[model samples]
Target: MPVCFNPLDLLMKNITPRSQIKRGENHSTRDVLLRLFLLLGIFFLLFPLRTVVAAESSGSDQQLIRMSEILRNKEKALQEKELLLREKEKRLAVLQQELQQKEKDIELLRQRAEKVLAEFQALKDEDLSRLVAVFSAMKPVAAAPLLEKLDLPYAVEVILRMQPRKAAKLLSAVNAERAAAISRSITSAKAAVE
Candidate 1:
């Protein structure tokens, strides 16, 4: 005959017992084996899930730490780049100031050079005028030979500076070829101005 076990009785016996059982003395083998198997089953069923959850938590923590580290590194790199940019801007500002100062100095030098050149040109004009006066005081026959010996452009310039009456007398004394060439140069110069 098969023994009948009630489900309610088994649950009630496992939940609460009347007798106080001593350790390793009056326990049945079946009872001990059943409890051992139950504990093993619980451990097998729950341990892997707990391990999976712990592994996922650990992975997430590591990832968060890596991301934080990456962000910090990026922020540090940006700060360094910004500092370099500021330094470059400061250097650029200094260079621009230097360039402006150099330009000012160049302008002052150019002005000085222009003033010196103007003064030299005034002296040259004064000398030319003095030469014209000396030539005018001379006899045309004497002045013409001296003027003819000068470069053609210089001779033309001296003649143009003289009074028209004095220039005509001097030209009459000059060689015909030189007088004609001087006349041609004067005509061309006037044409160019027009």
Candidate 2:
């Protein structure tokens, strides 16, 4: 294998005087060359140190870039969350509006139902009064058989609406079982009212 000489060594060799070329010959020129080599060796060593420092700086820059990228990703996630929250808020607002509208509609329906119920109750009361007048004109014996054929509740209502003396005569004319049941229903209804 061919031996390779360092370029610095070749330069030193060329600068030496012909008289000092002999091996082990000490001279001022040799000392000067040694000093030059030491200084150049120090410079070469420091050059590698500078390269190491530059590499470290570049590594820090890469870390900064990575950190910045992470921050950007987090910011993007936050923005997406904010958008989702806004969408949810919009949905909630719409739902509230719908709920309010439904409540208004329910209120209107309830009012209408109340009005219809009131009209129906008035009509029922009028019909009951007319029925009472018809029954009151009849003799107790004649009304009693017809009242017995009616539904229990209707018969009881008609009898209760008549004068006390007429209602008593009618009750006496009715079948004992039906009269007793009607009396029980009337008693229970009065008890509930009290």
lDDT digits (tens) for residues 22-97 of candidate 1: 6657777667676766677768867997999999999999999999999999999999999999999999999999
Q: Could you report the Cα RMSD, in angstroms, for every candidate shown?
A: 7.8, 8.8
The TM-score measured for candidate 1 stands at 0.73
State the weakest 10-residue window (summed lDDT) of model 2. Answer: 5-14
- The candidate 1 region of ten consecutive residues with least summed lDDT is 9-18
* Per-residue C-alpha lDDT of model 2 across residues 54-75, encoded as one tens digit per residue: 9999999999999999999999
Which stretches in model 2 have alpha-carbon errors above 4 Å? 1-39
Each candidate's TM vs. the true structure?
0.73, 0.77
Segments in model 1 whose C-alpha atoms lie over 4 Å from true places: 1-14, 17-42
> lDDT of all predictions, in order shown?
0.87, 0.87
